[model samples]
Every structure is written in C-alpha cells, then in structure tokens.
Target: MGRKSNQQFVQIPLAKLKERIKQLCGIYGIRYVETEEANTSCASYLDGDSLPKYGEKPDGWKASGKRIKRGLYRSKDGSLINSDLNGSSNILRKVARNLGIDLSRLGRRCLTSVRRIRLWATKSNLTLKNARAFTPGS
Candidate 1:
C-alpha cells in the first residue's frame, strides 16, 4: 500500500492581503492605474534603465582608493575632542544654507537621530567638549 500525502491550505483576510500587495507593488515600482488608458500612459513613463544590476559598479565609477579624510578635532584614538564637528554635517549644513533652508529647519532635518548624529560628530572631529559647549544644557 502507498502512503497518503497530506496538504493544508490557508486563507488571508482581504484587507491585509491588499495592504501586503500594495507594499510589494511600491517596492517593485509597480503602478496600478484606474483606467486602461491611464495604465498605457503610465507604462510610457517608466524608465527601463532605473533598475540596478547585481554585482555591477554603478554609474560614475571612481576608484581613488583613498579614505575620506577626517576633519580636525578628532583624538588620536578616533574619539572626538570637545571641539570637533563632523565634516559631512558641516557640508550638509552648508548645502542647506545655500538652498535657502532656515537654520532651525536645517538643524532639525540635518540630524534626526542623536546616536547617529553623535557618531558622525565624533567621527568628523567634533569633540565632546565642543559639542557640550555648543549644545544648551549638555
């Protein structure tokens, strides 16, 4: 006698299923249009070249083999002294200023997370002493 095979089927709720589908579509850049004509129009707008290829160096490939030079205010042990600010933070703030973003807005948007901002600040040579002095109630 042959052994019988067992199988099980599961059903998901429609709303949850739709939400999952929408997330998947967004990840894959799939546009769902209401009408057939709209779908055709959307298809024309898609860029076939935007998809990234596996194991390929992206456009504007450069190989200088140089590490990003750290800014002043970093200690010999790679910790920030009391005076260093992250190089990238300075650059971002400069760009934001050039683009006419308010200083308060730039401050808010430039460093969203304290941990990451602190790390960047330390890495860029913004020392703990300087950071505390600049920040109120540090």
Candidate 2:
C-alpha cells in the first residue's frame, strides 16, 4: 500500500487488461458494463452509505466506516472487515442499484463469514497462525 510507484506501474497495464476483459466477454456473450467506482473504496456498504460519484459527494460527506489500515476496514460498530471485501461489496451494491436488484436482505454475517482460499506450496504448511494471519485480524 505504500508503493506509489508500483501502483503507477500497475495502472499502465490496466487499460490493456480492460480491453482483454471486454474482448473475452464479447466472445462469451456476457454483458459487460464498466461502472465508475469513485467512492466504492471509501463508502461503507454495511452502513448503507450513499455512494456518490467522483465529484458528486455532498459537503461534509463521510462514511460510517473507514480503512483503518492496509487491507482492513473498520465498520461503524467497531467490526473489522477486509478492505478489499468492503470495496467489493460497495461495487456490487452499485451494480445492484443499476440493475434494480434487491440486496436489502444481505447482512453482516454474509460478509464476515466469507473464507479466503489460499494456495500454499503444501497443505502441511498451512498452519493455524499462518492461516489466521490473512483473516479479519492477526
């Protein structure tokens, strides 16, 4: 998260990656629509924050949750969830809004219980400490 140069380098290939995704979607007859993810990374999905566009946020707008540290987001109730997961949920919420899908039933348990699958060189190497290291908190 501290590597600005690495982020810039990654951005260089993003356009190409988008093009490839578009091509693949077209081939597979999958609908693809690129949506603007302005405040997705900052807004709290659990708190139902009004996710606005890049410059459309109201004055003094603030999320009920925030990224407390790298790869972690702290919710309004002091619960910590993966930052990427929170952003991803916000993105899905945006898409659902556009599609008029009802996600009102989705709750904290659904998000908190999500398990991340890791690929280790060997199964024995996946110790409890190492496994829990990447979870909500260390």
Candidate 3:
C-alpha cells in the first residue's frame, strides 16, 4: 500500500480505538481528558523540570534529565528512569496543575518499581503477559 493509504488505514482503527476508550471511560464514570503531550518526553519529572509548550522552547532551555537512549532516561541525581514512565509522569504533571493534585512526594524509586505488562494479540484473543518489575539502571 502507498504511504498515504497506509496512514489512512491506521487512522481509521485509531479513531475507533479512541471512541471505544471514551465509551469505556463513560461507562466507568471516569473522565476522559485529552491533554497535549508536547515536551513531556523531553522534560524530567523527577527533577521538576519545566515542561515547555510544543515548539515553543525558550532560549537555552534545558531539562535536568535527558533520554539516554530509546527506552532509558538519565535523571539529575544520576538515576535511571524508564523513558516512557518519565514522559507519562510529565503528562500527569500537566493536568495535575489544574486538578490540584499533589505530586511533589512522587519519587524516581516509585517509577522504577512499577510492574510492566506486555500484551499480545493472538488471532481474536488478547493475552496479557506479566512482565518483570522495572529495575533501575536496567
């Protein structure tokens, strides 16, 4: 398939997935919020780094922690955090400001201790695999 056609095909299912997520949230009485994830991955939640708007970084702006590789982030305290978790924490920080949620007590250790789950789709069945707990500096 051509590139454009491939993207369209992918988008169709993504739209349906989003709709289904909204429906599930509604059924569970959970609020479905869509927040911009602009600089979430680039900023360090452990260091309380400022999250800049997408493409609007200030002059010489820098975060304390940085992505060391595809899946790892090096924090300011020389600790390693999962890159995905770091980004997710920053995204939560974005909405926490408006929701009055306190995240100051959150620490890198908690992030590293999270259990990772791997999901597999076999034919029409979905299987969940219990991935090992995330170890720091792994």
Candidate 4:
C-alpha cells in the first residue's frame, strides 16, 4: 500500500502543475503565460552563443545546467517570477520595502517563506482569492 501511494505521489501531472503555476502567478499579481509557441533566443554574442570567452567563468557566472522549465510571470509593475529564486524574489523585495518588512536577516536569500510573502500580498491586496493551498517556501 505504501509503495502504491509512493508511486502515485511520485509524479504530478503537468496539467496540475500548470494550474498551480497559474494560481501562484495570480497570488503574485503577475500574468502567467507559457510561450511554447514562440521560437526565441536570448543572446548577446554576435555568433548567438554565449560561452566562457576567457577560459574561465565571468562575474556572476552560474550554470543552471539545463534551462529551468518555468512559466512566464509578468506584472504591470515589472515584477519577475523566477523558479530558481522561489517564485518571485523581485516582487518580494519590492513589497518588503513598501511594507517596511526587514529582510536583512535573510542575507542574499533568494527563497522566502510563502506565509511571509502571502501576508505582504494580502496587505497589498494583490489577489482576492483565499490563499490556503500554498506551503512555506513554495
């Protein structure tokens, strides 16, 4: 029985994940859109390939390995939603500043508690839906 339950829990359907993504974006007051149809590349180099030019990693050089599978979350206020940083660090910082929530304790922290951010969101009235399904640090 435990094995069966584990097997069932091992995979969450992509549809459910997408729905969760939308819910999460709604909480952040951001537009959630998966632009799978768009064939675009983010590039800076002339050859359209960004690599280690000097045989070493440059400043802020971090490899996420394969590109993170994330949905596009945009806000009119220009907030960003990054999966690597626990949803949206940009929004959190902005909200914290506005609400005077001291986050210095979490130095260079990307991931933040959902409760904290949710409280901030609630205070700002970003969404009307009751946020009960979100867990901490989601």
TM-score, per-candidate, Cα-based: 0.18, 0.66, 0.66, 0.23
Off by over 4 Å in 3: 1-12, 116-138
Superposed Cα deviation of residue 69, candidate 4 (Å): 21
Off by over 4 Å in 4: 1-9, 37-46, 49-138
Cα error, candidate 4, residue 40 (Å): 7.9
lDDT of 3 by residue, 17-119 (tens): 8899999999999888877899899888888899888888899998888899988999898898889888988998888867666775667666775564322
Candidate 1 lDDT over residue span 70-96, tens digit each: 322332334332222232344334344
Query: In the order shown, what is each candidate's alpha-carbon RMSD?
Result: 17.5, 9.3, 9.1, 14.1
Kindly report which residue stretches of model 2 are placed more than 4 angstroms away from their true locations once superposed.
1-11, 99-105, 113-138
User: If the candidates were sorted by their lDDT against the true structure, best first, what order would they fall in?
Assistant: 2, 3, 4, 1
Clashing pairs in 3: none
Clash pairs (backbone) in predicted model 2: none
Once superposed on the true structure, which residue ranges of model 1 sit more than 4 Å away at CA?
A: 1-85, 104-138
Can you write out model 4's per-residue Cα lDDT over 24-118, one digit (the tens) per residue? 99999976655331112121111112344334546775432222345433222333333334323433443554557665544222332223333
What C-alpha lDDT does candidate 3 achieve relative to the native structure? Answer: 0.78
Global CA lDDT computed for model 4: 0.42
For residue 4, what is the lDDT in candidate 4? 78
Residues 75-129 of candidate 2: C-alpha lDDT, one tens digit per residue? 8988887788788778878888566657665667556656653323355566765
